[model samples]
Target: MKQKAWAIHFIYAGIFLLLAGGQMYAVESFQLTPSATKFLAHNVGPGPDTPRGALNHLMVNSGADVRETIRPPGWIAWAALSAGAVMAAHGGLLIARKK
Candidate 1:
């Protein structure tokens, strides 16, 4: 029973570490600048300008602004990754202990 618990612990720890690593890497690689929107039209397409088109553009731009504002600091990512590593190590220790 103890061995089985330890094995499970190690498995969970490994998964956590993998997730943390990926998240940290993604944040590190992310750009702070907002990218150009390929889907949004600068002006009303072919037809006359309508309130709907203006509203759509406004919504898209606002969403982009929110995303840009909400990015986590690099240090935060490092801290999260560190926590994940610690959890993984603790789980490994559990696995190594005999019943």
Candidate 2:
């Protein structure tokens, strides 16, 4: 009975970690485009040079042209991969113990 309880606990923990890590990874990887810039420009009053501008000045060309991009650090991918691996290992151990 105790072993079964432990197995269930490990399984649940593994699933939760895997899902949370995946969500973090997805959020970090998502990127915005020029269309988003146009939408922001239309909805928002400020231009790219403004303090509240959505696009960075370095990437923006003049006040009318704005380009936005997102690039996640390699560490984020590594962390996600590590979390997934840990989850797989935990599940594998749980299954092995049952045998």
Measured by TM-score, the strongest candidate is: 1
Give stretches of model 1 more than 4 Å off.
2-7, 10-14, 28-69
After superposing all C-alphas onto the true structure, candidate 2 shows an RMSD in angstroms of 7.8
What tens digits encode model 2's per-residue C-alpha lDDT throughout 10-99? Answer: 667766667766776667555557778555555654665676663444344345556555567767756766776676677668778788
Give lDDT per model, in order: 0.59, 0.64
lDDT of 1 by residue, 1-99 (tens): 767686677668766766876687686454334343314334423222678666556655675552223455677666766777777777777767754
Clashing pairs in 1: none
**Ten contiguous residues with the weakest lDDT in model 2:** 54-63
Regions of model 2 farther than 4 Å from truth: 29-77
Q: What is the TM-score of each candidate against the true structure?
A: 0.44, 0.41
